[model samples]
Target: MPNYAESHRDLDSYISARVPVIGMRTIEQQRALRLVREVATHPRRSSMPFWIYTRATGLRDLRTNAPLQEDRSLTGAMEYAASQFTARPNATLVLVDPDDLEGDTPLTRHIAEVARLAGNNSGSIILLTDTPVWSGLQRLGMSLQLDLPDADEMYGVLAGFLTDHQGIIPIAWSEDDARRAAETLLGVTEAEAVNLMATVAAKGSVDKDDVPALAQSKDRIFSDLTGLVKVQLKDADYTVGGLSNLRDWLRRKNQLMQADLRHTEIRPPRGVLLVGVPGCGKSLSAKAIAAEWKLPLYRLDMGAIHGKYLGESEGRFREALETADRVAPCVLWIDEIEKGLAGRDDGTGVPQRIIGQFLFWLQESRSRAFVVATANDVRSLPPELLRKGRFDELFFVDLPDAQDRKEIIQLYYRRYVKAEPDPDQLARLVDLSEGFAGSDIEGALHDVGAEVYLGGGAEALRPSFVMDTFANTIPLSRNNPEQIEEIRAWGRERAVAAGRTAGATTQGAPGPARRIVFMED
Candidate 1:
């Protein structure tokens, strides 16, 4: 992926500059072909000889999209493209998803030879693919990694299609809501976005009610991501048990995420580090944020990515990160992150190398991937990972207080038991669940749900059943009190509180330990 700070150019610029071996990466092959065609048909380049090649289609004339019907092998395509540059000046060739382009093979060498021939003349040879080309070949010219439309561009697409259908049907989305809808569809191509618009208007109306459904609809076209597991969010996941501070912060940052910031210098929040007690909704909060924002949720299992072969882990990690970039404007959940990046230095130095790589990616990545990393052992994390600007914020999620515990009870009770607990029942259950983590409360409710499911149904479920389950359950906080307090003490001094305790007047955010400022002399 190109750096977010870099500006993209019109394809015509390459032809005007007479760039040879122009390596372009895009999944939308036809779209890219059309762009190349447009550049070729421009008045200045109108008289230039143009050719295109694909393994399936063989060689074709760019003018008519007509096949030349000769040697259909890659050798024939390069032979043809090479002859054009040598025979005439200012010619152009487009190779679309050709095989054997990545390494120093016969085809790669031929392309390099063709590139040199074209370079000597005022001609261009374009290598268009969704995959990377060989570095040696690419270095002969320039490269561009085409990305999907950002929010502003996507909004234009949505408005154009909907405008054409304005008088034909009901269209209820205003510009703001339409923009939000477009933000939800960020990972899709322009063609895919148009098709999705058709799906929305298929029923003869495009209403604001369909906005949330955009994320749901986008699930149909998610890219085949490797190593990163897609996490499906339930409706209940939209409402987490506690962490009011974290929730409020997310709500505020969401505006920036959905805004058309193409014209602005500020970027969206990179993400937050949630360090807190186990089962205090740290992991669940990541899901809740994605659900609330109506974005796709993906979990990067750091533990599963480790490989025994040399540099195998780094390669897999790179692939996964690339996949994340491909599907941006989404949530990346790294649960129990310390388990992977932090461990006893086994003298291999692999852990340090991986940590360095991860930190660098986190700092420099321009994709709008909101990373929600949760860690129970905050102390185990390397100090550099917690630097002031590494994450947007580091939130400390302490064990839920009585009020938070009550909300947790009610939320899970309503979700799992299929009914709301009455006020008195809620009060009794809240008292029973004191010192319980959100997961502990949820687990007890799950037990009730399972028992009710086995015995009969919701009719068989009772408040006593929930109370008894909570009573018998021993939360991790109680099972290991000393460790919990140690974590709490560390958080109290260093991190911001995710949930305010009883009688606390104001929630806190992490304050910088030091400050720096520069001014013109």
Candidate 2:
């Protein structure tokens, strides 16, 4: 039902061609063994007897549950296998968990001898293990790999699981919900998928409520990892004040992100690279993207990816990326990505190699882990990274202008102060906070609210308080004028502005300037 026709055909072909040895790495040992039996015992094929061996189980008949008790050890099993071909050609010996085999004494030589002898006869040896192949056995054998089950297979698994537990557990999923859940459960092993579904059913129901639980299960997959962190949103709808153009683009792509777009020819959207001033809501946009899209947000701390041991960084990085893929249809936020990739070209080339791996994966991975990478300093970023096709788009989030400032003022005031400033007051606040970033507006309003709370309670928090506090506070743009100017210059020619403006190219243009309005000082 899961359609192992391709794998079966491949195995049958190898056996028919007298390939003496076959090697495969897989977690689903039972499934692989069943496939081998199916191929070996076929009605049309010659009668090829199959035997199995493991350290724990020793040597046993593949068709019958009978065991060869005397020849149970690794050496004994190898000797028995080598002897069997003399009497019975086309005998297949399957070894399970060869990594558990003790010592190097004659096991390697015996295995090699078996390979040589098996070639003369039609006998074959199949080895299975989860460990990386470090032994020379690979040279003598054809290596194969079993892929994770596809959607149709997973749906069958889910449907069968639900049917099996219908009386024992409650399942409220519609046909569509079951299909969607099966789609999300793709990329994980059959065991993992089964366990996850069982987990939901254990709670007595598998419905819309189980969907978040399924996503949260993916969080557990990343919990032990060092580099990636799960970001928790206080409000699932954490909206950004500005970035009109970028926001609109995301709005359009939202539906595509929600569905299983794997089968489609159109490559799913890779994601955007937000490059701009430090306090211009680049990082915040990452959180907002997850909230707005209704996807889990994982922050990949590039700084934490490195390790002291050799190859550890790459291994951790690969695992992290794999985990992200496993949890598809999610947002991966790499904050200040340039910091991780900067200065990588110098030194030992570890960081450079990491960047190389990241770049390659970003372009090639079919996984829908929409990457939202934010960078403050464009000069630190490598030219290759910024080249076309690295990301879907590169957006420059500059300082909030007049209209954006007003939106930020109102949004934050309502959030922190729990009171909305009327239009007249909001306009005055925006004018006073010109050249401020969305973050600056929020911070200034928060500080004013604190002072008002201490001096005169909620009634004391008014437009004048915000104006006074903002006027005294120096925003990051003002404090680091040279840095902001350099970033703006870099973005002016290369990047698309996140906000809307009049004389804009299809790419983007800087938004309108801050309007000057005199408020009581």
* Per-residue lDDT of model 1, residues 12-83, tens digit only: 667678888788888877667766776677786667888888888889988887898678888888877777
The best candidate by TM-score is 2
Q: What is the lDDT of residue 197 in candidate 1?
A: 90
lDDT of each: 0.80, 0.76
* Model 2 global lDDT (CA atoms, 0 to 1): 0.76
My TM-score estimates for the predictions, one after another, are: 0.82, 0.85
Give the distance in Å from residue 481's predicted Cα in candidate 1 to where it truly belongs: 1.7
Clashing pairs in 1: none
- Tell me the lDDT of candidate 1: 0.80
